[model samples]
Target: MTINAGRHFVTIDESAAGERLDRALAAALPALTRSRVKALIEGRRVALAGGQTIEEPSRKVKTGERFEVDIPEPEPAEPVPQALALDILYEDGDLLVLNKPAGMVVHPAPGNPDSTLVNALLAHCGNSLSGIGGVRRPGIVHRLDKDTSGVMVVAKNDRTHVALSKLFAAHDLTRIYQALVWGAPKADRGRVEAAIGRHPVDRKRMAVRKSSGRNAITDYWIEKRFGPPLHPIASLVGARLGTGRTHQVRVHLAHLGCPVVGDPVYGRKSRNAKAPAALVDFARQALHAAVLEFRHPTTGEEMRFATELPQDFSKLVQSLNSVK
Candidate 1:
């Protein structure tokens, strides 16, 4: 196996016999993701020893098969720069922290093709963006759901991106969220230690399954209660993540029988019946990334940020209190 210039040449050994072409390529080239390998194959940049192009990603390969993949130069991002307003909290050469509002898509996808955070960042940062991830996702380090409003940090360069990613992977950063839940927990504060994975029946949803799931932990405490003291209709809770997973806080809260208010997927509509009309009318999940703390990747200085609830959320809470 040899790598020269931008091309990779590999001869499959017995260990890789009968593996799919994409899988073999991914295994051989640790730098490229499986999706990237598939893209290369589909683009006709991959060929066998005799220049036989293999377009199918799932094609089986035999031992001693030789192949070469012509790595193409990365194409520029297609998302047009849109001069959208951004709520920047902090900015530097290494990274930028901003408050992502609800209803704003972080990146472009099938349903959302324009006016995303990436597009806005491209306009704001201009050419000073990291291309390590991909052209489409230039400076993205981590992601918050489109509807989950809160503070997020975007990397400005590859060095900062890698550093921030390592911090998140090690759970060395502080991420505190506030949520309005449908029900109050029996205890004032507790921890939900469970495993989370994709739902078996509904592939679009996440589930808390002890088996075939990744470890997830969430620590939550009741900040305030709404409705009667004995039987509250809702409760404001503070959640701190112990492990970051897809919908970890939501899934763990749902597992505790207290789904987030207005969470269309995991929430129970029946629970809304007892709540104030204003609370029920709230759209999207009543979850906010209220606080974020981490060490600066470049300066190594401890940085912390906090944000108040959005106007809508604050108004809803006020409405809940006014309910007789």
Candidate 2:
């Protein structure tokens, strides 16, 4: 990778031959994902050698081919504050515990510039922040993916940030999520241990990799099955993350043949095509971070918090229970 006049350039090598145009380029630019690269290609922000612009992300590239990519300048440095409501469970001088709603991005990003948790924190914390969010990020020690409702802990100072970061890295805390999945597991409870990494061919999604992937584990229990005994339509599951990776609970449950209902990315819709209308009409992934437990960074005392299911989630459960 090389930079010239605010543009990033990558020369394809023998190793990258026959790779998808977006995949090859994204591999060179670690900061960009294939989906983002695809967006750039379609937006005419990517060009090939000899000053030829390309707009096809699927086009395969060969050795000796080179591409130039133009990344637009970022919008701003610090996120502007917003007066968003927060469900604060606990707070003090060094840290805060709150229930983050689904559909709220944890921080500001390209398309989502404001109304994020970080923006809300800026307004709520006022001048008390210690600037631990790093340049482009906020002081979030961990994240519950956007659209994943849950309890999260935010740092107010740098010391707390580092301490929480180390604790999460070591997997010394507890995280349990509740999800409504399409089918019940064969047993009452089980554990899934798999290594996850970017899908090799489809760079936009993650997959369980046979090799060259990071360790991930999820322990789950079948709390209740909502349909017939032999062939249940869906189940309420309690999942404990032994290790947290991106989409860990969703992916692992999908691997267990029980994809979370309303999960667009990893669900098997055809399998449940004839299921009741309750699940068919529901939208968004039926997953929530219900429990978060850890030791307070400064005080060294243990802490635990559990969040209630959103109203929509509760209604969905009621509908599922009424299914034949």
**Which candidate leads in TM-score?**
2
Backbone clashes, each candidate: 0, 1
Off by over 4 Å in 2: 1-77
Model 2 has an lDDT value of: 0.83
lDDT of 1 at 84: 98
Candidates in order have lDDT scores of 0.85, 0.83
Clashes in predicted model 1: 0
- Deviation of model 2 at 184, angstroms: 1.4
Name the regions of candidate 1 deviating beyond 4 angstroms.
Answer: 1-77, 271-273
Cα TM-score of candidate 1: 0.78
RMSD of 2: 7.6
lDDT of 2 by residue, 1-324 (tens): 432334677999999999999999989897887897898898666767534457789999999998877776564556888899999999999999999998999987777888899899988987676576664466788888788898999988889888999999999999999999987989899999998765544434567877545789999999888878788899999999999787889888988888988888887673555488768767788899999999998889999999989988888998777666
What is the per-residue lDDT of model 1 for residues 7-56, given as tens digits with 9 covering 90 to 100?
67889999999999999989998888899899988866677754445678
Error of 2 at 35 (Å): 22
Q: Can you give the TM-score per candidate against the true fold?
A: 0.78, 0.79
